[model samples]
Target: MSEETKQPVMIFHVSSEKGLNEIKKGKLRGVHFFAETCTQYLSLNSSLLNQSDIKEAAKWICSPPVRDKSDSEALWYGIEGKVLDLVSSDHAPYSFDEKGKFFMGNNPSFKEIPNGMPGLHWRLPIILNKVLRKQCNLDLHDFIRITSTMPAKIYGLYPKKGEIRIGSDADITIWNKDKKVILTDEMVVDGSKYNPYSGFELFCWPDEVLLRGHTIVKNNKIMGKQNIGKFLPTKLSDYI
Candidate 1:
């Protein structure tokens, strides 16, 4: 960071108070940084530790550990205060039957299980439905800032990736703020039926997602096949 004049942003698949404090006191230097707390961090807790088999619960495990309710509450406070800046799915799917054996009979130590759950497809809706429903006093613009603009700016994609104005990439998500959907494995494309978010009722969904003049997601489903992505350089020279 001293060499580049850039403070390292932390992207924890799960939130940790200890880690947060470490960053707050570390070599961060007044350099701006953004933390993207994933869905698992915002939603799950550590009680899964008590499962009959730790391995079975392994799939639900993420790094830095899902702390207790106090940690979650602290994270909530951070978000409300603008200390935390972004939320993402961090979505990696592992099959349930594959994870069932670990938790089925023998509880393993916290380190014994595989980690990650599916939600790349449902994160935005889940946030809009659950958090926004509580009337946290955040306007739709706040939503755009955290989920879209801020991250874009930090990553050098700002004014290019996040905006709806002319000359932007035309990538836009049009939300049906009143739409509803029950989150289920059936709704995901990762081919994993095991979602920590299963049984969640999503009240806000995107009805249209456009990518560079092409529509990609419509009616709650992705319209394109996988691997349609092209590589873009993130080097400063590439943008300059």
Candidate 2:
């Protein structure tokens, strides 16, 4: 149908190697399909679930549960080859209490556990470290594409939300590559207090943040006025 009408199909939070292979096959057939994967697929794996500690395993109870290392490498290849159009956090904010992931039981079934954990704050740091360390085989350019530019373009936020050209929103982040951060669960907010990516050591992080030309953050400090955000309507991009 996509090939017939030249319409695009977006597959969200993609995590399977077989699925990506099929998407590649469809692309070869002239299908306009874009796939987006999250940090879990690219940086994390299912091995954490093998632990005897259900408390630890519970942190990874996400939909399309994190897969093996081979699958993760495949997803990275997909991003590098442009077979994947975007990367996302899929930041579902389910708490660890009985009101959320633990609602069904003290040790709930995977079926009963809500499929999400807090990782939004760690997504960039984790990937940046791997990319900089030559672990992911992706350059800084690829990192920016998957994390910012491509996502903005594909989701119709380009020019304004993605790039740094004239007339675009002055949204920019200055990185301090020399700065290092030891990951901890305390860094997360707007969700549970646990971070599945805790213990990761990142060699860089945003030192300054600007939104629409306003300085919002500097060196982990909040300096901007609150509630300045606006909703944006989108046109699914034809970039793919």
Candidate 3:
């Protein structure tokens, strides 16, 4: 973007104060910059990277390593204030048992390990955990906006993928907000035995998920088959 021509830009999985500050400057100039942060940045910190176990530390490795608690706090503030427009999983579900954090047969260098962590299974529940704890002044609407609505609109899926409007696809998630549980890797159906959030506590999680009115997941069990979905046309969204 320049003085004359402006375009919408989105920074995915942003987790640093420096990036936020730059976006702050752009916002003052009215630039159409959108930013997204993943749930790990909101909960995890760089302290894990400093541990003695390389294998343990590598589980937390991603493109931009998780920063200090201060940066995480700033990101939470960004989410609470709408400075960060969306939250994503950026889910890289590679088991450390393989090439995820290890080389042929030995523990790999941090640079050698594939970046990104596993959390597509817990993105919603983890953020909802923060909302339940009232840590970031997050509400249910904010959750829906960042995790669901905005991403759909930004990607041109709009009222079709995000909302429950009449005639819209019945893609929905039913949540049991009062449920309490401690996380474990066995619960992950993505076939990734290692999870960075293995010990996380959650107050809410999805009870069921419907795709195009088909109940795909219910009571933590997947009932839908693969390759049953269709492609959606790519169109520029007007709501953005």
Candidate 4:
């Protein structure tokens, strides 16, 4: 598969020094690291399992489980050094009950927990807020590049979707740095009844969002009709 594909193989939840070394090796051979691997490693430490309540610890349980608490700084340095390519949520949402399945048995184990958490809505805000608070070295331009431009280019959406040029699609997110949002279950538009980011207070949020020149979100509320998103087809050449 590697020889035939000739495309970057994306790795997930890389949090160890060994993993970082592997990512560096993979990049030379066309490999990329998913952003969540870096962000979650820095944000949620393995110590949380011991420090917080069971429910809180359960919320942080995802694949490639959060690494040793000591590795956070090194992982952040990896992102800063451009060892990581793009950011993604992996946006998988499982209900609270499904996540609790690990604890249902007499002997609870991390292995029984579901493998994902909801972050579709929180991805942008959390990263941007981090930048705002000076927690990371990223600037606004870097944020846009990692979150939008790079992903579009990677998937062949390029000039059509990533840019704000005259002929490009008007897909846009208007952020208000001054606006604050307290993330809670009620604000989640996804079907999940619980959000892993619930109670997070974000300093910046999207005030409006447009899709193909149509207003889809206004005042942070979804206004577009369901099933309005168009599918995009990408060619392997686009990846190159």
The top-ranked prediction according to lDDT is 3
Rank list by lDDT: 3, 2, 4, 1
Question: Judged by lDDT against the true structure, how good is candidate 2?
Answer: 0.83
Query: In candidate 4, what are the lDDT values of residues 1-240, reduced to their tens digit?
Result: 443666455566676766876676766675432333545666666775674456567777777777785676666666677676577776767666643434465345667766677778787888899888888787878788777887787667887877899988999988899987898888877666677767778899888999998999999777999998777776653555
TM-score of each predicted structure versus truth: 0.79, 0.92, 0.94, 0.83
Shift in Å, residue 239, candidate 1:
13
TM-score, cand. 1 vs. native:
0.79
* lDDT score, candidate 3, position 183: 92
Better of 3 and 4 by TM-score: 3
Candidate 1's residue-wise lDDT over 1-240, tens digit each?
422766354555438776555444442456455566776777778886558764556656766567776776666666666667777787667666545425443555655455666768766776676566973445677777777877677667767777888877888888887877776656766656666777877778888998877889898677966787776545342221
Pairs in clash, predicted candidate 2 = none
Pairwise TM-score winner, candidates 2 and 3: 3
The residue-level lDDT of candidate 4 at 193 comes to 68
Could you tell me which residue pairs clash in candidate 1?
53-106, 53-107, 54-107, 54-108, 55-102, 56-102, 56-103
lDDT of each: 0.67, 0.83, 0.84, 0.72
- Number of residue pairs clashing in candidate 2, backbone atoms closer than 3 angstroms, sequence gap of 3 or more or interchain: 0
In Å, residue 82's CA in model 1 sits off its true spot by 2.7
